[model samples]
Target: MGDLERELRDLSTWLETPEPPDVRAQVRERLHRPARRWRPLAAAALAAVLVAVLPPTRAAVADVVSGLLRFAGVSIAVSPEQTTPSGVASPLPGQRVAGLDEAQRAVRFPIRLPAKLGPPERVLVADPDPTGACRVATLLYDGGALRVDAFDGRLNLSFHKEVIPPGAEWVEVNGDFAVWVDGPHVLSYVDRAGTVHKESARLAASTLIWQDADVSYRLEGARTQAEAIEIARSLR
Candidate 1:
């Protein structure tokens, strides 16, 4: 059978299995609800009547992610280290980044932000010397009210800001080639030469890209396009 049909059938069988009384009642209430026929008809009619009535789903998600990033004034990039997996040890206190040039290896100064932004929730430092040749740092921020930032050799921004449709999940079009169900929001950086990537799944918001000679970054979060643009502009 088709995947969707198979999934529905499996779900039906699971629902038929024995369950606690309360759980069973809740399931019944959900499955036995009256079908709304007019709604579909109405949607079709609306589509016919107004060509622009519904925004494209992928565009909608991208817009959301971009907006949030812009609001935070963050930048996206793809680092060279991301393309190759590095088995680096976790950083200990008071250690420097290994292998990088004297200047590139260290931030030298703390990152100063505008008054509008909050400090990161957590910071991860990688061992200066790892078994492999690769070395990088990870920075995490928990922007209050449901925003999370995971910045490693790459940066990922995940915000549980909206209610996703049942069975919905996030997907990326490009960058490191990974996918997950119930995955956190991600903004990643890779080497400069890689092709631009685009991804679309349920509730994606938007994806943004910034490039430089050494690193390139991608932003995937739940914000509007204007917000995403603002964040992109803030990177210096």
Candidate 2:
């Protein structure tokens, strides 16, 4: 977290902000089911996914949001070549150390842990809103080589945006659309207050993002798409 501290100290000035597997039709069918079980926001999110699909290819799903490419509630803008990964990651906003139980109790939704990776080494929670609910829960594993972050995306659009080149490919996470970033990227998000903030020192090696049961998650530092998806599908 070198320059990251400096950047965070300055703050106040920042901007914003997949895949297949399983049968493609299966993904569409799964997307359809959420609308019935969820409220209107889920419906809107489902509609976005469905339209990208009809009711989908990775390219077909592309929708420009705030002048950046977007999909599955995440936005992307390519990062510059000059900057390189420092092998360190930025913590989520308002993040604090906590036990797993304490972390789960803080969030409205379930904080799923990947069964494939067993228990995480550490649990962190971020409370960014006034409602006393955790906005994000992060699990760190393998000396931080693997990390999973779960956040409520039902009410937030463009919640996680990244600045990395456009080659992120599509993969499958239990029949839902997921995106994988193969290289390091700059991560940012819109807080509950709608202010933009940068995930300083956020140099992701590889990432897999998918939404399940209204929780949107991003798993970082996996070395390959297959491994990322396997861990993601094992979430429980």
lDDT of 2 by residue, 98-176 (tens): 8999988998989887889999999988855777787888899989788988877665443445554554665667765
> Tens digits of per-residue lDDT for model 1 on 1-236?
13322322223222322333324344334334443664334323322322222122111111221222111112222122212222332223233333224313343222322122343444333323333222233233344222222222222221222222221222222221111223222332222233222221122334443332223333445354444345444443
lDDT values of the candidates?
0.29, 0.63
What's the CA error at residue 153 for candidate 2, in Å?
1.8
For all the candidates, what are their Cα RMSDs to the real structure? 18.7, 13.7
Q: After superposition, how far is residue 99 of candidate 1 from its true place, in Å?
A: 19
Q: How many backbone clashes does candidate 2 have?
A: 5
TM-scores of the models, in the given order? Answer: 0.27, 0.67
Worst lDDT run of 10 residues, candidate 1, spans 53-62
TM-score, predicted candidate 1 vs. hidden true structure: 0.27
